[model samples]
Target chain A: MAIFVNADTKVIVQGLTGGQGKYHGLRNQAYGTQVVGGVTPGKGGTDVEGIPVFNSVAEAVAATGATASFIAVPPKAASAAILEAAAAGIGFIVCITEGIPAQDEAKVYNTLVRDYPNTRLLGPNCPGIISPGKCNIGITAGEIAELPSASGPNVGIVSRSGTLTYQALYELKQRGIGVSTCVGIGGDPVPGTNFIDCLKEFQADPETHAIIMIGEIGGSAEEEAAEFIKANVTKPMSAYIAGVTAPEGKKMGHAGAITSGGKGTAQGKMDALRAAGVKVGLNPTEAGDLMAEIVATLK
Target chain B: MDLFEYQGKQYFARYDIPVSPGDVAYTVDEAVAAAEMAGYPVVVKAQVQVGGRGKAGGIKLADNADEVRLHAGNILGMDIKGHLVKRVWVEHASDISKEYYASYSLDRAAKKHLLMLSAEGGVEIETVAVENPDAIVLLHIDPVDGISLDVARDAAVRAKIDAEAVEGVADMLVKLYRCFTEGDCDLAEINPLILRPDGGVHALDAKVSLDNNAGFRHPEWEAFRATEELDEREQLARTHDLQYIGLDGTVGIIANGAGLAMSTLDVVNQVGGTAANFLDIGGGANADMMAAALGVINFDENVKSIFINIFGGITRGEEVAKGIVEAMGRVELRAPIVIRLDGTNAEQGREILANAGIPESKLTSKPTMLEAARAAVALANGN
Candidate 1:
C-alpha cells in the first residue's frame, strides 16, 4: 500500500541507451521493478538485457503501456525529457539528473501545473523513491530498504538530501523496521515535488503509520511543510534539518537556499517543525531513533 | 554568479534594457580614464558584491578626474562587510526625478515567475513587501504567456506608478523580463528605475545573478570566472571537481553526499568537536578522488584529525575501502583519520581498511556514524 508506487506499477527508462541510465535501469530490473521498456532517441530498436526499447516516451507508452518513467538524461536534455514524459501522459516521472537550470525547471513545473495536473514529477537532482519489495526506482540501494515488517511497511520517509535518505533507511533497517516509501524530493531551486506533496500522500496511506522527514539548510520548503503537517497529518512524525554546523556565508541565488528575511535557515526550520509537535532529531542517527520511538508506540 | 554592477549593466544592455553607461576600473588611473571617457559628474562605485555600498562610503560622485581618483583610491581597497573591494565601476551619473523598483524572480511557493514592481524604490524591496504591501504590485507571470508591454503597463498602473512614467516603466519591464528569461538569470533587479527630468526611464543600478547551471549554454559567462572569490582550500577542491566548503574547526570531515557531509558536521559538533570542512566525494569514490580530497584537507593547517564517513549507496563499499587504503599511501599524513563504512559492501570496505596494516595511531574504523564521530573528536582533542 505504498503511496505513489507498488508491485504492479509499469516503469520505463527514459535514457536507457546511456551509461548510467542503462546501468541503474538494469539494477532496478534486478530488484524486480517492472522495467517494461527503455527509451533512447536513436537506438530504440535495440534491446538491453531483454527489455523492450522505443525511440520516444509516447512510443513506449503505446507499445508497453508504461505508466511511469525514470529519467537519467544529462542536464542539458533533462528538462526536455521530463516535458516529453509528461506529454506522453506518464503519470509519474522521476528525474535523477542534477544541474538542471533553474529557469527550465520553473517552466517545466508551471507547465505540469497548468497543462498536466495529473502528472507528478519527482526530482531534477534527487535520489528517486523506493517502495521496497514492491518496487524500486532511482538510485537507492535496495538492500538498505527492508521489505514490509509485521506492520506492513509502516514508516514513511521523505527527504531533501539523498545521502541522508539512504542513511535514514539503513538506520531504520538495522532496527528491524521497514519503510512504506522513501522519497528524495531533491534540494534545488524548484523541485517538481516537495515535502508537502509527499506528506499529503503519506498521511492518506493507511499502511504508513509513522513518518520521517529530513531537510537541509536552504529554502522555505521545510518550514512550509511543517505548517502543512501541523493541521493535516495525524501520524507521528520525526524530522532532521541538516547544516546546523554549516558555515555562514553570502548566498547568491534568489531562491532555494536563501531568502531576504531569514526563512531558509536550519534553526528556523527546526523551530518551525518542533512547534508543530514533531520531534526534531539532532542528527541522522537520532532522527532514526525518534522515528523508531514512534513506530514502537504505534501499536 | 552575482555579477558586479558593471557586469549587470552589460547584461542589461544585451537585452536592450536602458542602463547607465559604465566601465569597470581596477586602478585609480583606470577610474579616471573611465570617468574622462563617460564625461563629467560620474559615479565612482565600489565593485564589491555586498550591498549598502553607498552608505558604506564606497560610492561617491566625482565631477572631475581628481575627484574620481580620490574616490576610487578610497573605495578600491576599502573593506565593506568583510569584502575587500579590488575594483570600481565608474559610470556617468543620471539625473533622477523619482525612484522605483522592479525585479524578476521565482515565487517558489506559487511556482511561478514573480515580478515585483513598486513605486517606492531606492530601499530594500523586502521592507516594502512588509510595510506598505499595497504599494507594490506582485504579478505572477505564467512562463508560457510571459510578459508583454500591455500587461506590464497594467501592472504598473495597479502599483500606482505615476501616469507619465508608466509607459517608460512598462517598456523597461518587458526588457527586464527578457533578461531574466532569455539571459538565464536567477534574479534581475533594477533598484532605482529612475524617471529622468526629460521623462525617460533609465536604470540607475543593476543587480543580476546568473544561474550557475545555465553556464553550459552561455559561454560568455566565462568572463565572470575570473571574479570568483574562492579561499585557498576551495580553490584546491575546484581543481579536483570535489564539493568542498571550508569551515573553522579541527576535525576534517569527508562524506559521500551533500546532506551526509552536512549532517556529519552536526554530528561532530554535537559530540563536542567542530568540523574543519564539508567535503562530499559523491557517488564515485576512486583512489584519485579520495587522494585528492585528502590532499585538499591536508592543506588546511587547522585540521587536527580526519573523519571518512562513507555510507555506500551507489558508491560501492569495496571500492571506497580500496580508495581509502590506496589514498592513504598517496598523501602524507598530517592528521589521523577515523573511518565509518556502511551500506553496499561495508563489511568488505572495513576489512580492506583493517587488513591494510595501518597502525591504530594512523587509521581506525568505527561501526557507526556516532562512534566514528566520537573517535574523531577524541583524536582531534589529542585524547
Candidate 2:
C-alpha cells in the first residue's frame, strides 16, 4: 500500500563489493527489503550478506528478477553504473553516491529521459527511499521510521536534506505518525527526482492521507512545488524550509542550498507555500507536529 | 568554485574559445608591464567573484601606462559588493560592434542542461528575463544528444542575433557547450560575446563556475584553490577538511548535516542568540572530526558559547558523545558548550557523557534542540 516501494519490489545492489554498498545493503535487507542480489564488476560468483553477486546489472537482473537497483559506487563510476542499470531495464534506481560531477549527472539524466524512459532515478547524493514496514532502499536508517500502523501509513514525506529528513521522520514517528513512503531527493544542483514529482505520487496514493515536505534554501524548486501544489495536490500538506536565518549567497553546505542573486530565500519559499494554503513550520519539530495535527484531524 | 574573469578566460582559451588576450596583475608595476605587453588601450578589470564590478568602478579603460597604474592601484584593493579585488586582469580591449550573451547551465526543475542566449547582453540576465523575456532564447539541451550545429543555429536566430553574426555566434555556442560539459562547469557564461567590426566574435567576459564534485577528474583545479582568499577561521577549517562558514555571531554552532547545521543557526536565532559560524562535521562524528571542528570554533574570538547538536541516523550518538569528550581534551576552549544528543543510541551517548566526569560549567547536555538552544543562548549572553 506504500507509494514507490513495497514488499514485492525486488532490489539489487550495484556496488555490493564496496564498503558502503555492502553495509547499507545488509541494513536494507534487515529492514525487510528484498535484497535479492548484487552487481559487481569482475566478482561474479561471490556473495555479500548471503546475496549472490553478478558481474553486471544484466546478470543480476536475469538471475534474481530484480526490478530496482541501489547504486553505491564512487563518484567517478556512478554515472556509468546508472547507465548500466538503466540499460539492464531496472525500473527504479537510487544513487547514494555524493560528490558526483554535475556533468556526469546531466549525462545520466539525459540518457534516462531519452533512452530509458521507464527508469526512475532517485538521487546522486541522497539517502534514498523508505516505505515503513515494507521495504527500505539506499541509506535512510530503518530504525527511525515507525512500523506500519493498522490503519496503514498515512503521511508521505519528501525532503531535499538527508539529516532533516531523518529528524522529521523521527519526530512524526514519536508522535504516532507513520509514513507511507519517504523519499530523499538529495541536495544537489540537479537531482533525478524533485518535490513535485514525489508530490504527484503522494497525491495519487490512497494510503497517504497527509504529506510532509522538508526543503532547504536553494533554487526555485520549493516555489515551483508550491505552484504545483496549488494546481494539483488536494491532500493536507505541511512543510518546513531550512536556512531561514542563513545569509544570502553563502552555500549552507548543500550544493543546491545557495541563495543566488537574492532569490531562493527561506522566507520566499515559506511565503509561496503559505500562499498556496500549505501550513509552513518554522523548524523541523514544528513541521512534524503540524503534520501530526493534520493526521490526527484525518482520524 | 567560481572562477575569476581572468581564470575563466584561461579555461576558455584551453577550449580554443576566442578571448581578448589578457594577463593578470597584482600590483601597479605588473599592471603597467601587462598593459605594455598587451598594447595600449587595455582594460583594467578588477578580479572579483561578485557581480556589478563595472558599476562599482572595478573596471576602467586605460589608454596609457599612467592610466593603467592609476586604475590598477585603485582597483587592486577595491571592495566590490563585499568581495575584495586582489588582482586586475589587463587585456587588450576589443572593438564591439554588438554585444550578445550565451551560457550553459543546469535547469534543476527540468533535470536537463539549459542553454540561454540573448542579443541583449552586457546587463544582468535576470533583469532581461524579467523585463524583455522574449529577448532571451532559453533552450533545454538533452544531455545525451548535446548541442548540435542546427540547434545552436536555431537558438541564435531565435535570440534575434544579427544575421551576419549568427554563424559565428552559433559556432561559439557549440564550443561553449563543449566547455560546459567537458570543462565540468556548473555555469559557463559569456556576458558580452562581442561581434567585432572586423567580422569576428570573441568572448569579452567569462564567468565559469566549475563543479567541485568533479575535482577528481581535474587535478589542475588545485591551482584555483591556491588563489582562493579565505578568512582566518575559514582557512583553518579548510585545512582540517571541515565544512565551516565563519559568521559574526557569538554562539559557535556545530551540527551533523548541512540541513541540521542551518536549522541549528535558525534555532539559535529563534532563542535570541546569534550563531558565530556554521559547521557540519558530516556523517562521521569521530574523535578527529570533533576535535578539528572544536579547534576551528575555539579559534574564533567572537564565540561566547558552542552548541553541538547531533541527531545520529547512520552516525551513532554514543560514538559522537565519545568523540566530543575526547575532542574536549584535545583543545583548550574559551567558551562553554551545550550539547543536544538525540536519535540512535542517544541514551547510551548521554550516559557516556555523564560518566566522563567533565565539569558541568564547561560541558553540559540538554534533552532536546529547543532546550539546548535556550541553554546555549543564555550561556552566550553570560546569564
Give the Cα error of residue A104 in candidate 2, in Å.
1.2
What are the runs in model 2 whose C-alpha is more than 4 Å off? none
Question: Could you tell me the lDDT of residue A215 within candidate 1?
Answer: 90
* Docking quality (DockQ) for each candidate: 0.61, 0.73
Report the C-alpha lDDT of model 2 over B195-302, residue by residue, as the tens digit. 999999999999999988888888888989888778999999999888899999999998988999999999999989999999998765676788788889999999
Question: What's the true lDDT of residue B287 in model 2?
Answer: 66
* Model 1 spans > 4 angstroms off: A249-255, A258-260
lDDT of each: 0.88, 0.90
Measured with C-alpha atoms, the lDDT of residue B80 in candidate 2 is 92
lDDT of 1 by residue, B1-383 (tens): 78988889988999999887778999999999999888889999898888889899999999998999889999999999999999999999999889999999887777789999999999988888889888898999998789989999999999888899999999999999999998999889999899998999988899999888888999899898778878999899989978887889999988998788888989999999998988988765666788888899999999999999988766778888777777788877799999988877788877888899999999988989999999999999989
> Roughly what TM-score does model 1 have, to 2 decimal places?
0.97
